[model samples]
Target: SATLRIELSRPSSSEFTFDERVNRSHCSVSVTNMSQQSLAALVIAYSILKRRRKSEQKRSCWVKPWIMQQSEFSACSMLAKELRIEDPLQFRNFVRMSSQQLQLMVELLGPIIGKKDTKFRTAISVHDRVMVTLRFLASGDSYNSLQYLFRIPTCTIGSKGTIVQKYEVFPDTREEWQRHAEAFNVQWNFPHCLGALDGKHIVIQAPANGGSHYFNYKGTHSIVLLGVANANYQFTYIDVRCNGRVSDGGVFQNCSLYDLLENGSASLPDHEPLPGRNMPVPHFFVADDAFAIRSYILKPYPFRDQPAPNRIFNYKLSRARRIVENAFGIMANKFRVLRKPINLSADITANIVLAVCALHNFLLSTRDSRENYLTPGVADSEHPETHEIIPGNWREDSTSGNSFFSLERGKRDNYTTSQRDVREEFKEYFMTPSGEVAWQYRHIV
Candidate 1:
């Protein structure tokens, strides 16, 4: 009788045979007919060959040659370095921010947008990512254009919620609301005013099979950016993604902000009398005729058949509402993305608008950027002594094909009697010594 067993170990195979019938003899056999060390060497040689083939294949397909040289030849690397070292003004124009401001933003956003480097390749720097996004916004160029310029693949920038929430803050406290009101009173001579509200139509490509949901009266597809701007031209409250077909009043009625204001939960200050007036008035937002008049909101009297006092009130409201218009103007001027029909999806376009609004506030936070970004005559300015209006550069392009269009006026009958009374009170106040500005009469005339 014979028993056979086979064992394989360390790339070598051995067979053992035992015979018990005659003398219990034992014998050993080698399965490969080669020395154990030789078999082990052959196995090791085969593994090395296979690994080499895989390594060569990976090297051939890993990344494009131009992409690999991004550190040295990329537009972001070359142009940004030269502009930063040579001409800071051009650098500001290039990135829509100063070097210092860009560095500060990078530091703020680094930890959140930062990526861990892997063994195969290094992660993209946060600064580069920001620069790419800003360039896209500043030029309104397509992702393909940006990829060629920045030497990066086409991708959307992320982590915008932090910046949007931090900078574009609504006035939620009494003090904050009073701060805006005080600014309006001092600058625009409108008291008890929290902000200037309006809607801007941002053109976009027609959605696939969307029909008339995004179609506007202008024969284009658009989404509305409803914003309330403070006296200093910073957005305090913004509602985006509203359908263009809806009237401004309809959009306002549908927004959560309208509910907040109507329910007295928007954290507005208590009703207070105008300066030198006895009537207690609620703090309200000033809007255009496109918006419906409410107890907490005010619009101008009709354009036709207005008396002197009503005209004066309308002029004053127009002056205050100019801030919101200027806010949109300056933003569109600086970030040209809004100037053209954004070709991205509606969701991405909304995110882009929110991001630009946040950056608009961020750039205004510092004195240098504020002054440089919105230099004299860049935005509508009031003469300190004469109180004359100096039209901004944005006005030069008001009729340009790229600029935004005004919202269609809503139904005039939508206002209530009490809302009309509020307007009348303002009309009466504007003609009085308390709320009247000396130049208001000149403008009205």
Candidate 2:
């Protein structure tokens, strides 16, 4: 009986003081002195009038008179260079893309997000939606600011913009991943390094009475974005939907990719002999010590050992795994939304992250990126350890990661013999003359 009783809490204080605000009239309606049919008709007509009045009031609140005055400086006429954006620096500062990049995005997103008008409501033009969404991504401006600046309905700009963002962020081809592995082999001389793996926390405002379901150790609420990126700074595979409290390893264990890796369904590369060696090592993703050693995954040795082999191994692995860090930096710097906490639901935030990942890959593919526009939080030259990992953006996650995949194995040895075998073999190889890089020794020793 006590549990069944409802409890009401005091409302939180608001920025606008309620003392001088308009008070709503509390009254009842009555109709009399008419036949039953006539009275019912009169009531229905009054109801319709009330509904219309409420709708008009809501419309007036969002749609301002200033929009009409600013029609001359609309998105296309002012932003697209119709009025001529004389300063290239100014253009990049506002929209976060060059004129050429904007045109390319318009072409790419047009077919996917375009729609037709129905009898009920007019359809928004694809141009307006694309440009505004890009502007939001680049500048991290509030939805209200975008609505007023672009002179479009806030609801349309936000809703349709999210629709464009829902497209899957995974690569169109598996070849893209293979290309990344090849690049690591040729450029970094880190053979069999298929990709760099890592996880980032996408911060969001905690839901009411959320407790700790969204809380992370960083004292913030977030959803984990676990991604595998290649040497070209393109995301090859990503798991966008996971609880924030999940660790880098916890997210990895829960995803279907882990099962694929376990069952050999991932179609990984063959075991080719090490250069000038008789033994063959299978292709694998390089992650940090946050991840456990696995047959198809590698990590640096713990800080305890003082062996030269371990030092060299850590150096080589660090060089390879650092790619994912740089990739995340480039993405957050370019798409400012990731730089700050997203004041949206976890589901919507996931979509925004995925869409930006897809867009980042698209941009990386189309251009050389000699002059990428990067902000401070996420820059190309940023070192992962020195940076705060997107500070002032972590949210509180209440969910515990106890039920995540790794726990299913039970608490026996925490690791299997095969896991140890994999790490040992890789360690020995990096110490060998064929696998050793000259700069590695200077840094490690």
Overall lDDT per candidate, in order of appearance: 0.79, 0.66
Report the error of model 1 at residue 284, Å.
0.5
Q: Model 2 Cα displacement at 388 (Å)?
A: 22
Candidate 1 lDDT at 190 equals: 90
Report the poorest 10 consecutive residues by lDDT, candidate 1.
17-26
Global CA lDDT of candidate 2, please? 0.66
| Candidate 2: worst-modelled 10 consecutive residues by lDDT | 402-411
Over all chains combined, what TM-score does candidate 1 have? Answer: 0.83
Residues 1-445, model 2: lDDT tens digits: 1111112222334633333221231224444455667666666766765575455343334335656444466775576564235776676656666777767677777788888977644556676677788778876778888877787767776686452433343433456546666799886678878888887777788867788988876678888888888876777788877777665557778887788889877777677767776667677899876666677887776665668878877877877787787777667756777777788778878878777887777666644433554334343342345321233111121121221111111122244676666667777777778777656666654
Give me the runs in candidate 1 sitting further than 4 Å from their true place.
1-60, 156-165, 398-403
| Cα RMSD for candidates in order | 11.2, 10.7
lDDT of 2 at 200: 77
Give per-model TM-scores.
0.83, 0.74
Candidate 2 residue runs with Cα over 4 Å from true position = 1-64, 68-71, 79-84, 115-123, 163-178, 369-415
Kindly provide the TM-score of model 2 when superposed on the true structure, using C-alpha atoms.
0.74
Q: CA lDDT of 204 in candidate 2?
A: 83
Candidate 1's residue-wise lDDT over 19-63, tens digit each?
222122223333455666766766675566556444534233566
- What local lDDT does model 1 show for residue 118? 88
